[model samples]
Target: MNTHTRKLIKLNAREGLGVSIILVILFVFLSVSSEYFLTVENITNLLMHSVFVMLVAFGVMFVLSTGGIDLSVGSVLGLCGGVTGWLMMNGTNMWLAILAGLLLGTLIGAFNGMIITRLRISPFLATFAMLYIARGLLLLFTINEPIRNFATPEFAFLAQGYWLGIPMPVWIALAVFLICYFLFNSTSFGRFVVAVGSNQEAAHLSGISTNSIKIRVYALSGLLAASAGILLSSRLTAVQPLMGTSYELDAIAAAVIGGTSMFGGKGSVTGVAIGAIILALISNGLDLLAVNQFYRLIITGLIIIIAVGVERYTSTRAKTA
Candidate 1:
């Protein structure tokens, strides 16, 4: 209806296309370079590995959409998984242990929110502090050991089982993506998130409770991260206190690659899902090519930097337009 609206739409489309093209090119290269890449088993493994990162990416996308960041997600995931495994090992009911883990994760998120919003701490600083606190508590609980319990068949099924030839973890990931997609695209709260990210003062003047939204965004991020932990532990039937080290970076990279703006107010669940797949593909491809593990880390870091640079350029162009 207007030139400005058309330009905004075109810009968003361009951002989405950029990530999609990268994913496609990478996929094609992997498929062509590795004969095993297209195998059913390898594809299944790729989806399974990507599921956890995708879950965390969804949480990151939400926080980024609200112009906030939470660096504690990876630590919270480890802590939740460790706690749940510890509970199960000590003979707690599987369902109860899972619930407890989720609760603790949500509480940690709320804590981060409180400090950042109420205490006027920067989100980066607040969540950075939480990262250490959560990891420390996890180590204290587990004594720096992994929890292994053989009694929880039901819990194990959450990650390892299949329904109609699809892994349970994939189903779980799909369910999460659907729920988040709906929340981000069809809800008043989602609109509020975008508004707040775009301009806090304007959103506040429009009667939005910016603080409350930020708190909830962080809490949701924690909840999702906890869920990822649960699935990861279930898949391994064990949990280590430091299992999720550096996972936050992967999640952030996925969100950024998926067209979630670092400056906020823009994101897409579909894009994030594709981004997760791309990361998983890169890892799998590298492994197939017999690349060094250390090199993989370097490549991942480079991708993150590149994605952020692209986001910055796009944001600047949009503003100028």
Candidate 2:
């Protein structure tokens, strides 16, 4: 109805279109690359594999929307899973152990956010510091050893069980998507996030409480990171301190590829979901085709570069026109 509303809507439409085009291109490329790429089984496998990255990407989307980054997510996730697995092994209640893991993740997130907002440090530096801190804590908790979850059937089921032939992780991912859709589209906080990203000084001047928003985004990111860790731990039946090493890069890559601007203030969880799926499908299809693993990494890097270029071009064109 208003000019501002109209602009936001248009921006969202362009992002959605970009995601659709990306999905189509990926579909065509993978389908042509390997005969097994479009099979029903492979598609499901791809979805399952992508769920972890998708979960992380969704949360990363929120963080990036607020013009921040969480490089510590990967390590925080690994540490949470290792801590939970160790607790379960020591005879803790299953639910309590999971809660503990989530709490640990939240605390780590708060620490990162506080350090950034309170100390006026850049998010990159703050989260980068926590990345190593989390990894070291994880190792200390497990005594530099892998923690097993053999005695925790319930916990394992969180990652391993399926209903009606669909993996629980897939369901969890879907639920996360729906929740994020609402959080971003229907809530006051979501609008604040956009405002803060668009112009932090204006937001602060308007009494928008930018610091609190930053803290919330970081904490949410941590929660998602922990969820990914829990599901991964369940499936693997073991938690290693190094489990999520470099995964933050994948999450960042997915968000960037999904039309989320690294400069901030523009992106959709839905688009990021599609981006995560695209990455997952590429890896899965490549494995099925027996392509070199190293080549896959190369292709991934190219995709990120192209996506960032596209975002920049679109933004510049919009600005000039």
Candidate 3:
């Protein structure tokens, strides 16, 4: 094979190895640290909890592949859930309400894309602004209180129900992962994403529609965030004004910790799945060990910092080599 193909394979191998090693280390640590961590029930519960973040991280991985960030995901999650719940409360059909919620998320993401591509706004500024706009909209709808009394038994099943004894959310997450894996590994869109991230101007000069890619990436991110919101809301049977506050942090952390480059042009669906588990394990193990819950946030921050540092170091080494 060609040098380029070999290099690409090597890169992917390194990315997977780094994160897999971390996963193994963390898994062993958690297993040894807490007896409950090794139990069937606890492991299953932990996997269930990790799937939500994994969904969001998948989208974030896509956007990050294009060297962009979507700070609006957390708010998108809340707003989408609120929209669906509000519709249900007003007698809208359950399926339609869920569809509307997904559509809203897609539109918000598309809007963020338009603003960035058409208006030439930086992704950070555009998405950060959207973060507040979406959050404000969510708060407006649930101003008096959370949206409730709308979750039908069927609706509750979206998150809580099991398929073949596996949680419904697990099935949903697995489907999403498969789709993302196919997109990232076996499609032109994925190549374009990497090319654009590697050098947008060069990609554009080569006839790539860089703007379109950015818009689509952001929109995909929004859709995944919305899916997470719907599932989370269904499980809880309510949508509060601030249902998804700061969830973006978890999403970002998962993506980065999974070996997705902060600088872009690199990401892994498998790594992201592992990263989500690692992040969840931190919170779960702490809970089991009777540590302060807030420490999870601190640990997440540290992990992100360390991950970024490692990315920078490896990138520099590759360039110098």
Candidate 2 clashing pairs? none
TM-score of each: 0.92, 0.93, 0.93
lDDT digits (tens) for residues 1-321 of candidate 2:
699898877765665565567678878988888898888778878899999889888889989988999899999889988878888888989899889989988888888889999999999999999999999988788785568844466777787888788888999999999999999989999889988998999999999999999998899999999989888888899887689999899999899878787767876888889889878877786797798888988877777677667755665665554
* Least well predicted 10-residue stretch by lDDT in candidate 3: 311-320
Off by over 4 Å in 2: 2-10, 311-321
Clashing pairs in 1: none
Deviation in angstroms for 314 in model 3?
Answer: 6.5
The local lDDT score (0 to 100) that residue 251 gets in candidate 3 is: 90
Q: How accurate is candidate 2 locally (lDDT)?
A: 0.85
Model 1, span 42-87: residue lDDT tens: 9999999999999999999999898889899999999998888899
* Predicted candidate 3 versus true structure: per-residue lDDT over 92-114, tens digit per residue: 99999999999999999999999
TM-score of candidate 3 versus the correct structure, residues matched by position:
0.93
